[model samples]
Target chain A: LGLGLTASPLRAAGLEPNSFEDITSYNNYYEFGTGKDDPARYADQLTTDPWTIKIDGLVEKPGDYALSDLVPQMTIEERIYRFRCVEAWSMVVPWNGFELADLLELVGVKSGAKYVAFETVLRPEEMPGTRFPVLDWPYREGLRLDEARHPLTLLATGIYGKPMPNQNGAPIRLVVPWKYGFKYAKSISRITLTDQEPPTSWNMANAREYGFYSNVNPEVAHPRWSQATERRIGGGLFAKREPTLMFNGYDEVASLYQGMDLRKNF
Target chain B: MIDVVNRSVRAIPNWVLYVAGAVPVIWLYVLGFQNALGADPVDAIERNLGLWALWLLIAGLCITPLQRLTPLRLIKLRRPIGVVAFFYVLVHFLTWLVLDVQIPSQIVADIIKRPYVTVGMAALLLLLPLAVTSNNWSIRKMGARWRTVHKLVYPAVLLAGLHMVMQAKGFQLEPLVYLAAIAFLVAMRWMPLSSFRQAFVKR
Candidate 1:
């Protein structure tokens, strides 16, 4: 098990994982609250045990599967990815999980499925942010069928070899390194396969600011801020902002977006 | 009771306001030095300084309304408060320029291209002349014209509030509240004196 962990080919090269303090304390989980520190303060109220994920829509096996039963069947590995936010901040995280392709194969995707939609669990009793309509409640996200089936796509279950922190999406979460961090739905409750394009929370909130395909392209700027550079979190007080790269330095995903105009798709 | 409150307010030196105003910036610097500002100290420092400036500016604007409506008189210390607020605004601008966006070209582009940055820069420019001529000598030399020049603060405050509202990610309540408070204060100056007198007489 130790040998397999160190030899994982998915580890990002020439990057250091952010300190556990920074990773756990700083998050953008709006389900908890909008402030960076609100999640750390309020997320402990979440109940993750006995959690079950409802998988339905155009799948051969459609049922609520216990997290325990699903996790044991897959081979989990460390995937150090460069996590970038649409707000122009970046961090390196060591996430441990199996591929989404592996999970989809286990359930079997119908041939006609065109998109995969994800929904976050909304428990107003525990998540205080739900009282206000900061975002349309029960945040949702989706990806193209090809994007969801990409090998780099992940369903992260742990961080730094430890159980995921409640603030950082405790039981399970999605991680698409090539896209912005918001694309990674947290504390997911339901995942559905559909033929039509599905709506995402940020895109639904403001289509002009956020697009369905939120690929990290430095050439494409957000309507409010420039994406040319990103400030590295945990780089100390005087750290200079490094120039951002296309796909957040993941050139492997470029082929996936081969002929599409990223500016329009952004 | 009103007399005692007015006398107590008058007893406090103007220098005390200036000294107290310096404490927040000094404490923020100390926190930055100790690495206690969480993961992103630059952003935290920049936001805190800007908020302090806005709060002080709003407090300075409240003096006229307070005197008009109630017996509380903080008029004597308004100059010190305005000067201290300008100082915080200057530091906040410097933090953004020096620490957050270091590239000179990018800084110039941001001021030109970004609407929020453009409005913020306009507010800072408007405050420059007012801060430079805040002393008694300028007031005496210019006489009534000093009041005209000082009136620039109304537009400056409005622009600052707009800058705050525009920069937020979503529709946040804090920035909106600041803008609303500023709008109410600015409107108070335009209200007819008869209404205020009638309200005071009734009270």
Candidate 2:
């Protein structure tokens, strides 16, 4: 916070840059594939209009709802969110979407719903990434019972107005700003209230590399890179680089699991 | 083929060689001019050029081994490819050191502390001497010392591969493939012929 220009011209965290700008412009979370920017180039072809979200498992109402019918029923609000990438980068983007708690409520969570798991549509033809066992096809993410209902969580439909760019998880996506960017599963078609710790795309691949609660803690370094420092995009060479904040500037919003060894949990 | 080769004074097709080098520069200019790469053109430039540098280095390393086995005579392009790799790596280094982060202290800190940065800088540094002495005049002037100086390319390629490995999130297929190719190149050069013979027939 002491890094001068507190409310910097870059806009406070959680504000959307624009229709084209994103809090996370630098990452390999490609909608089309793992290669960075593959989604930007190829995701324009995705169809979001005729979309369906299936809500089942521990939910009381197990049924598929048309996206149009779904949107009107959900409450939409803009929340300034701090997005932390698995990479050390951090950004404060203003996100406009319905709180996920509202949606889970709409579906009516049953008594047994302890863990809420989100799923992305897996199509080899559309998402070439799912074609190979690159990750456990159909990317998956989950949250704790309390975390699911947390105010910070969101079921994002549109970003910067209009519609969510296919590259940025068109139709609908989830935003868990406190955790690593991958926690925000994109192109959501299914939501299951599971009793177990739901399998995630990254955790399934390498649990050590990517933990379930991948909060951006500088101490818990990613096996490959350190999380201590990050590059501020467009911050020309001369501009001082910013040190990564604990929990990606969400210590206020979500720093409960402190004191305990983060390295062990990580 | 022989007659046309004679018509062209140069042993290789000059225009194609020129096109090979011009492609990256022209592509970069088009991106830079249009402002299509984004607010930070330096990252785009660094990524695009760094990848090509690694690719060309790998490609250059494959030449002699391929020549030994195949009739392609890839050795001709080795020097050209080395020079291209060196140019791009210099660009990658410059974009980060000059355009993106101007502070020398931070850059030095990154090199001294960060594993990936250290490997990347080491690879770039290794390529510098090779770049400066790449010309025919230097080769003629240095004579036998040129061979000694050029041996640095092997370690440079390894360092580049290491840099990619460290930068990736997991066991990345791309970097792994590059490492495998390096392994194959090494195998072809150093593997005892008897190892291949035993694996092929004895049983």
Candidate 3:
């Protein structure tokens, strides 16, 4: 409790850089825009100031909370972890954010809020990809209430000692390091608590590839590819591929899914 | 140009051969920037290798048309260049099939179930016949049929290009250039002015 803002457990883990110039340069974020770096480029146009999240559906306090009023209510902390994608790739990122649980708690998730659906702002003038029907507009992502409340789950707002880059899902993005990258939605505008499981973008498009609970386990391969091993990027020509860890190197997190069958869930 | 270069002179100096041999090796060294070899090392390792394999394939596809037009006599260089192209692609597919997937049967299942993978495997299957027949013996035995046998390279090139496009979630311009070049080369095949016949007569 006596720890300084810079000396907290969150600071220690978050100190490590999650988003880098190189990583940001080679990103695949589609919310702010289509190109990998478009989020970083076009995301600055987003006015995080005076921003209000529309918390609706089954929430007891179903109303708008300004970015200022809401952010201070939630704990801002950092967590260091490897982010693995179902596409058989991974990244070791140190996130600068807080737990999703705290936000849900503050909003007072209703007893009937079994599922949580998140939405990103959709403006074709700024985000050209939104103009195209790439997926359902506003870029929707959903999580089961339990999954949303998982300790590993994060509500990231910034990276690398800076406000979130437009490319890196600036302002606010979810950091669920265990799931595939797409599961960690970016540029969030709305958070709706629902009685039934909400339809997610990826699962709706290809249910076989993405499941509601997309925890990173090697045994449960995507219908298109296995998740057994992954390459350590920038490892030279002679360097060998590394075996992919279950829960994307999060044994602490993997314990949460102990009773569940990943294969069936996948 | 072909007469001077392609002719096998037993007493010829070995340095020329070494220079030719070192092309791919030297190029790879240059590409491996500060020991970072593949694409976006910060990203997943598999993505880097996958991009590298596609780059090699693109380069290989470029060789055919470039040689036909260039005065540098690149014809003698085609087979070796192609073999290297195949090497990178082999590594690319192998990285996915072995390290990523880990089981051959799963890979087989994936190809069957996924249209993207099925298209890629089809391109690889088509490449097998070209690789097998890439010998002087096959060229001599097949004779005029050799042209018929090699014509498969056209579709092989096309499928390889499509494999890149299919795997991509969005439009990228680089793959389009490779596809365009391959299309241009295929168009040349239908020309009344054959590049092979034109190469023999110089201005």
Instruction: Quote the positional error of residue B170 for candidate 1 in Å.
Output: 2.7
Model 1 lDDT tens row, A1-266: 88656555433353678888999998998877878899999999999998999999989899999999999999899998999999888999999999999989999999999999999999999998777777887899999989999999999999999988999998899999999999999998999999999999999888999999999989987877788998999977788998988999989989988898888899
Off by over 4 Å in 1: A1-13, B193-203
Candidate 2 stretches with Cα past 4 Å from truth are A1-27, A90-92, A234-240, B2-34, B62-77, B98-114, B132-149, B170-172, B191-203
Top candidate when judged by DockQ against the true structure:
1
Residue B165, candidate 2: alpha-carbon lDDT: 74
Quote the positional error of residue B102 for candidate 2 in Å: 5.8
Interface Cα RMSD in Å, per prediction: 1.2, 4.2, 4.8
Among residues 3 or more apart in sequence or in different chains, the pairs in candidate 1 whose N, CA or C atoms overlap within 3 Å are: none
For candidate 2, give the lDDT of residue A134.
58
Q: What TM-score would each prediction reach against the true structure?
A: 0.95, 0.80, 0.71
Q: What value does the lDDT take at residue A234 in candidate 1?
A: 90
Best by TM-score: 1
Docking level of model 2: acceptable
Which candidate number would show the highest lDDT if scored against the true structure?
A: 1
Give the winner by TM-score: 2 or 3.
2
DockQ of candidate 3, scored on C-alphas against the true complex (2 decimals): 0.20
DockQ of each: 0.64, 0.26, 0.20
Q: Which lDDT tens digits does candidate 3 get at residues B48-75? A: 5445555655555566555555544455
Give the candidate order by descending TM-score. 1, 2, 3
lDDT of 1 by residue, B47-140 (tens): 8999989998999999988888777887987898899999999999999999898889889988988889899999999999999999999999
